[model samples]
Target: MEYILGAVGLLLGAVIMYFVGAGQRKKILEGQSQQDQSYKLEAEKVVSDAKLNAEKIIAEAKLTAEKTFSEFKDKQEEFKQEKIRESREKFQRFKDEFKQEKEDELVELKAKREALKEEQAAMKEERASFKADRDEILKLQEAVKIQEQQLEQRNKKLTEEIERARQKQEELEHQHERFTSELEKIASLSQEEARVRLMEDVRGKTENEAMALKREILEAAKEDAAKDARKVVINTIQRMCSEMTIENTVSVFPLDNDNVKGQIIGREGRNIRAIEAATGAELVVDDTPETIVISSFDPIRREIARLSLKRLVTDGRIHPARVEEVVAKTKKELTQQIMEIGKKTVVELDIHNLPSDLVRYVGRMRFRSSYGQNLLKHSIETAHLCATMAAEMGMNKNQIKLAKRAGLLHDIGKVAEEDSELSHALYGMALCEKLGENPIVVNAVGAHHDEIEMNNLISCIVQACDAISGARPGARREILDGYINRIKELEEIAKKNQGVSSAFAMQAGRELRVIVEADKVSDQHADELSFKISQEIQETMQYPGQIKVMVIRETRAVAYAR
Candidate 1:
């Protein structure tokens, strides 16, 4: 019975196990079936999506094709239009070429017709010329026949004249032989000796007559040449108007106030000392109101000092350093100013082609003086005088220009910076030669002072003009100090004589008057004194004109009634 119950329980347990397994398997199968259905549904959806995508792709391809076709049509139309335009252009060019060819043919035909007409006219002229030439030939043949007849007549006349001339020549020879023998016997000499004596007499007479004629001619020429020379000089002087003033070494610097003098002097005169050392000039502050005198032998120095002082006074900065700076700057400016003055002078004088260095020297002449005359003014006057004289002497334009140029540059050496031992004339000549001046101009510059021999007419003109300019009245003046000293010396010279009691200088030192004591000097002695005094004046002193020495010795009975 336990076994039966155990078996039943096992079967029940087994049945229950089997049922549970079946249920699990049934659930798995259902789950598998659901997955299969889901897969099928997903597949169907994929296929539908693919069809839709295919339709969309077809639609896009159609659109692309239609667009391509439309573009092809557009391109085709453009190509056709281009081809048509090209064909039309070709046709027009062909028509134009044909027309041009026709026009050229017509022009050629017209030219041919004109040429034919000209040829016909030339042919007619040639026919007329041939006829005229034939007539001329006939006339020439007739003239040749007439000439042949005249030549035959001349030949006959010439034969008869030859016979007569031969007989005459024979007779003349016989006569000459007889005359020679008779001349020898009458003169008691050989034929050759007699001929020589006659020749000598004729030669002596001719020589004497020629010398007298030559002397007369020379005398006449001297008178005429003197008259012409005076006329030329007088004309040149009349044409010129020049300044008459003395150029002094001292330049007056005008100031706005007297107070500016103190500033220029500076503290302890350091400013002035600096100015002097820098410019090589002296600043003289004297009692003269509103004027400072800048004194220097070099006008350039005085000008620099003046300008430097002007700048210092204007800027109100007066010190040693500032003074030097201003003076240096002023010197540069003055140098540049000198160059400008030179250029202006050359331009105004119409002088050309001068070197820059030489031009600078010309400007320096403005600050130079010769015998109390401004060198530049003197040069200008001399230039004008030279030009005028050259013109008067019948010189051409080129020679006149040369004369003027030479005159202007004649005194260039006086302003030279070098301290040369040579005279200004020679130095000027060397400078001109060094600078490539014309030979004539160089000679004129050297010979103006008569230091060198003149080589040409222009050189003589320059010298003459220079003298005329300098020797003109009121053209130059003696310095006041010099004049006073000269006057005192003139009086002293007369007083130093033994017979003279008192002496006086008269006529601007042109004459000297000596009064002698009557008791000490007789009339004869007075005459001797005068001669001795005149000799002494001539020997000891250099003067412009003759100085008249008059010695007075008169007896005076003088009683003063009081």
Candidate 2:
């Protein structure tokens, strides 16, 4: 029984194992089927989504293509319309121009046709007129031929009468010759000797008459012109005799205080040396209180030094560096001041459009002096004279202004030069040319000093004005010592006279007044004394113009009470 049980158990166990294996295989198959279904569903979803996306992409491409084609079609239509419109406008314009050209050609052709018709008619008329004129000319020629024949007959008759007269004259001449021969024999003098004496007497009378006529004609001509020439010269002199102020080389600068002089001459005189070196001027510190004199052969340097010292003393900042800076600044200011003065002068004279460089050069002349005459002042006086003369002459005002400006600038080059060898005239001309001055001004400047020949009226006028201004009385001066000596000499001459008690030189030594003692000299003697002094002045002194000699005869009685 145990064996049998074991066999059954084993068989049951086998059975159970078989069933379990079968169940597991069935679950495995079911799981594989479910996984296949899931893979199939997932593949279907992917394919559906791919097909939907492809359809959407195709539809969008078609819509975009349609929009692009529509736009291209619209652009083509617009381009066609514009081209047609442009072509139409061009054709219209061409038609209008062609129509206008045709109208013009038609009018011109019509006018030509009318002119041709008129010319044809005129030619026919001319033909007829020419025939008439030719026929008239032929008739006049025939009449002239008849007149010529008549004139020939008259000439023949006149010739015949002349022959008869000539024959009669020959007979008369023969008779006269016989009578003359008889008379000659009776007188016993030949005809040749008588003719010779008659010719000699006629020649002598003709010569005497010719000489007398020549002398009378020459005397009349001389007498006619002399008065006018003298009058012109005298009038010119009288017109130019106006008074002018003389310029002096010395310039004065007032001091702020007397103590400033000590500062100017610093410790060990270093300030003076610095000033002299910087300015190239001689500082004349003399006994004159509250005043300093700047002296130099060069007037420009002297003026510059005077200005610089004045500034330094006024500023009270005296040092070597400050001195140089102030001097430079003062010089610059002076240059500008000169330019301003020059421009002002030109404006006052109505001179226009002067070159900038030439204006500056003219300004430099303010610092220059010629024989104690300020160049600028002399120029102003000369300009006035020129303008007055030019107005009198009815010359152009602009030309007169130019002449005066050139005259004023004639000595501008002296600002840079010291010697007189190279004349300021030539130097000024060169400067003006360099500065692009007017040709007329340059010419006047060059000609004023005789460095060049005068080429125009302005040049001549400028030279004349310079001479008039310079030669005027008290227009210029030399050294003071010389001036004093001249005055003393004149006074001594008047004092040496018998009637003169004292003599005074007046008007800057231009005139002399003599005071005579009344007891010693009578009125008649005073007149004689005046005449004698006038003669003495004229003979002894070389003075310009007429000097007035006044003799004062006064009687005074004085009594002193004690």
Candidate 3:
């Protein structure tokens, strides 16, 4: 029984140990299973996340493709719109060009049609004129035939009248011879001697009467002609003497400061000497208060010097080299100024198509002055006067232009000393001739000063223009002393004349009035005294305009007041 109990305890111990060990193994197995489950769950979770990520990536690719397709479509639409706009713009440009071309074509066609119409109209007028001429010739022929018939009838009547006159004359001669023979027998003296004395006495009386009638007719005609001539002269003078003022050439330049005068006369006078040499001018630095005079015989040189000096003073740079440079520049400027003045003159005068050289010559006259009169101004005035007279005379406009041009150029030789070898008139003529001026102009220029004989109307006009310019009142002046001496000489000449009680010189010495005793001078003697005074005045005086000599004959009978 003890052995059996021990065996049972051992068996129980082995069983308890086995069960505890098994339980421990089971817990370990369970932990292993839980770990495997957790790993499986984690593996499943990773596969699910991978599937989700792949789906997301595919979805994102699809969306990207759709977006790309949409963008491409938009791009295509935009490109199409741009192409359409380009086409429209191109179409508009083409349409405008076409419209303009059509308009131009239409205008050309219209002009051509108008020209054709004008041609047709001119042709019709010409045809009508030819027809009129034919009709006029026929009318003239008919009139001529009628005139011829009338002339034949008149000639027949003249022959019949002449025959009758011849028959009557023959009968008269026979009767006269018979009467003469009867008278001779009755008379105491011979017929031939009696007739001679009677004829001689009648001839002497008739001759005296005829001589008186001849003298009276001649005197009346002379008086009428003299009166008409005087009227014409007065009328011409009055018409030509318009108000004219002579213009002088005087240029003035202003200075900046007095100190500039020293700079102008630079270190040791080098600047002034250079300027003088370059411009050929005399610089007069006087006490005129900020002014200097540039004096030169050549007006152009003086103008250049004046301008150069002004520029130097203003720039405040004075040296020999600078002076030379400024002078050259001033010369160029003056040349341009001269040319501009010339061009302006031509334009003002309405003179076109002048030769280039001729225009230059005309400009040179700006620097020339004659007796205080600006040459250019005088030329312009002469041109205007000539043109006015020509218009009044109804002359050809081109001919008038030639005359005016010749008048303006009459003193052109004075501008060029080298060309002044000939007289002014001759040189002017040669210049015109070289320039191929109108023959009338060439001839007029040569003959203006009577260097050549006056051969054309233009020449006479030039001479008249010169006289008008020089002889008008205030047009010219002589020295005051010279004028006084001339007046004194005239007074002395008149005082020396005999039978003159008082003598008065008037009309600027153009007329002399002599008062003589009435008892000493008869009507015939007065005429003789006037003639003598006129002859003496002509021989002694050298003056323009004709001098009039009047011998006054006055016989006053005074009554005494009681």
Q: Which candidate is the best by TM-score?
A: 3
Better of 2 and 3 by TM-score: 3
TM-score of 1: 0.43
**Reference-based TM-score, model 3:** 0.44
Reference-based lDDT, each prediction: 0.78, 0.73, 0.71
The TM-score, computed over Cα atoms with residue i paired to residue i, of candidate 2 is: 0.41
Q: Report clashes for each candidate as comma-separated counts.
A: 0, 0, 0
- Candidate 3: which pairs clash? none
Write one digit per residue (lDDT tens) for candidate 2, span 1-562. 3333444455566556656755765687677765556755665565566556555555666666677778889999999999999999999999999999999999999996797688679869999998997686566556556655654565465456546555755665565556556656777769776446544664455445444544454365457546544654454444333222112445677897788888888876668868887888868788899998776666678888988987888789898788889889988888889789878888887778887776776677777767667788888888888778777888886777776777777666776544556677787788788878889888988888787988888888888888877755566764566667778888999999886789998866767999999988876567668867987887898764577889999999999999
lDDT by residue for model 3 (1-562), tens: 3333444455556556656755765688687755555755665565566556555555666666677778889999999999999999999999999999999999999996797688679869989998986676566555545544554454354445445544544554455455456657777657786556554654454434444444454465457556555655554444333321112323455677677778777776667778988988868676777777676667788789888988888788889888899999999988888788889888988887777677777888988877656788778878877777776778898878877887777777778646346887888788888988888888887887888987778778877786666544444455556656666776667667677788777766667888888887665566667766776776786765787878889999999999
Task: Give TM-scores for every candidate, taking all chains together and pairing residue i with residue i.
Answer: 0.43, 0.41, 0.44
Provide the lowest-lDDT 10-residue window in model 2. 238-247
CA shift at 382, candidate 3, in angstroms? 0.9
TM-score, ranked from best to worst:
3, 1, 2
lDDT of 1 by residue, 217-249 (tens): 446655755655465444443333122221366
Candidate 1: where are CA atoms >4 Å away?
1-247, 254-258, 286-291, 478-562
Query: How many clashes would you count in candidate 1?
Result: 0
lDDT of 1: 0.78
